[model samples]
Target: MKKSKISLETSFWAGQEVENPFEFLEVFFEYANLDYYKETLNHFLLHTNKLEAYEAGTPGQTFIIYTAFRSFLKACFSLKTKDKKLKVRKAPEKWSILGQASLTSEEYQNPFLVFQKAFDEKTPDEFDFFLCEITHLSLSPFAEEFEYDFITPFIHLTKMLDAAKIISERGIKKNKE
Candidate 1:
């Protein structure tokens, strides 16, 4: 009998790559039988989600959201590059979400606009979109061994939005008290 080796490399990108960055999580759960990994990711999202209660219009909310998002993506990339040391690119302007400019005055007032657009479409928000974009660009060099299909970058926006609903629920309970 001959033995066949499976390659760790993944390809599954069509022209229209799915907009949902969290799609990988679904695939991860479906194909991989690693409960601890699943639990860890779930916990991370829950904890992060707890940090920011989404109020329609609030100052400083964008900063909090951006910081949490940056950290989350960094952690995810670290997992992907476990073997190799990950370093910030010198020129973030070139190909990194870390370089995205601060929100303008209007946006600063209502960063929720981005979230609203994404919510209406039932797709990942702009941050998730950019995260996936940067991930693809940065990992292009390693395309041969890149696990794009499974590591489909961004944490889903819907998950965060869903978590926000808990805030309103808690408020209702508090009011009843």
Candidate 2:
């Protein structure tokens, strides 16, 4: 069966205006699937494919799609270190994806964005910091972090995958209704 192409972008943004941003994270996670990630790793891993998929063969919708993704992310993840708690610093309608944040490709793995950033000067704390930054998912216990982890990180990771799976199932169920 042919699935309907639904751009829930406007509604997604509207939700942000009324509700706490992260409240819609579960839905965001659905769109942030294999085709949705164009930020860092997804930007590189799927750049060629994204372009090739475009019949115009130019970066047409790419920029628009990217803008929406970044705006949503910047709204949700743009944080500032204030005392101990990190607070939202910017709620930009359009995020500037200039410099290193922009995707460039010539080649590629299971490229780990966190480990790849490892350098001599950076400390282990910084490693943990970057992990939270890249995932945009905090591991801080008091940050009211989502209950992803149970016994180990593996369990948490499993739960995340399962959540994604459930989201797919729910979509199918709704479409049938």
Candidate 3:
């Protein structure tokens, strides 16, 4: 039998052990209060939507897709920090959504305007403070007062693979339909 070449997509998903590692990590990291896993999942959903729009003759939709991609990158970087709690602080602020939308608006218009408007209407609550406190605690390690075990690159790689798998499956299903 002839051996088939493994595509980049296949390699990426394979790295995740073909399981929903993000969901697992979400539960695991819940105690850290970083919500990093949840953010990652959100980013994936946004990207999937953007890609679907693009394929349906809405090229302008790439704006949202690209924004989600950038957000995912930021989340990945935050995951690299020693303090898991601080990872939330490293997450891009809502302003980033506006900035990205601006960059892509000349072509697609500002799709994020709706999100910005909604955010503006909401007031910060106890949950917001709680999340901030967690972020502060995570960042405290960099203040020379605490230390944390270094996160291995393998773990990050695995998480990324899992995310990619979910994305690929979604994309494939969309294409097929």
Candidate 4:
């Protein structure tokens, strides 16, 4: 996959020296995987979640989360591509999320808003909405493959989903003030 490049000066997070966001992501999605993760998306999200904790809002998390979201969709695409019933092969290679978000608080194009809307619904519509979103949008510029290197609001939604699941599965609860 051909990856996009950004200058070191352009990619640094606030008060933190991080490598290019996409470069950091390539380490997991492209270079190597940890045995404990059991899945690439899990491993990738784990580290991004950690970094997000390192500093609340930063450009670094954007890239990390962006890659994670894309990686998540890539895995989903791989599974559903061959299933004619799903028709995932028709979706855009880079921007694969399901809906078109007309408004956003941060950087996002067409589909990022779509994901935010689904995730915000707080229902089971996320994946199902994505399935329909992929088949419905116009084909991206690339016909076969593309390596995208930017983060958008969609990544934030994935983290929210993970935390919600972890809070329940891990039995985490907030203490009343």
- Candidate 1: TM-score? 0.21
Which candidate achieves the best TM-score against the true structure? 2
Q: What RMSD does each model have against the real structure?
A: 21.3, 19.7, 20.4, 19.3
**Candidate 4 — which residues are off by over 4 angstroms?**
1-28, 32-62, 81-177
Candidate 2 TM-score, C-alpha based: 0.27
Clashing pairs in 3: none
lDDT winner, 2 or 3: 2
Q: Lowest-lDDT window of 10 residues in candidate 2?
A: 106-115
lDDT of candidates 1 onward, in order:
0.32, 0.30, 0.29, 0.31
lDDT tens digits, residue span 1-177, model 2: 995432334353334432333334445564455234433333322223232333234344444444344333332221111103322222234534331121212101111121222222343334333334323321111223234321232222222233223323332111121
Q: What's the distance in Å from true for residue 29, model 4?
A: 3.8
lDDT of 3 at 148: 27
> Which residue segments of model 3 deviate by more than 4 Å?
1-56, 83-177
Model 3 TM-score, all chains together = 0.21
Off by over 4 Å in 1: 1-56, 83-177
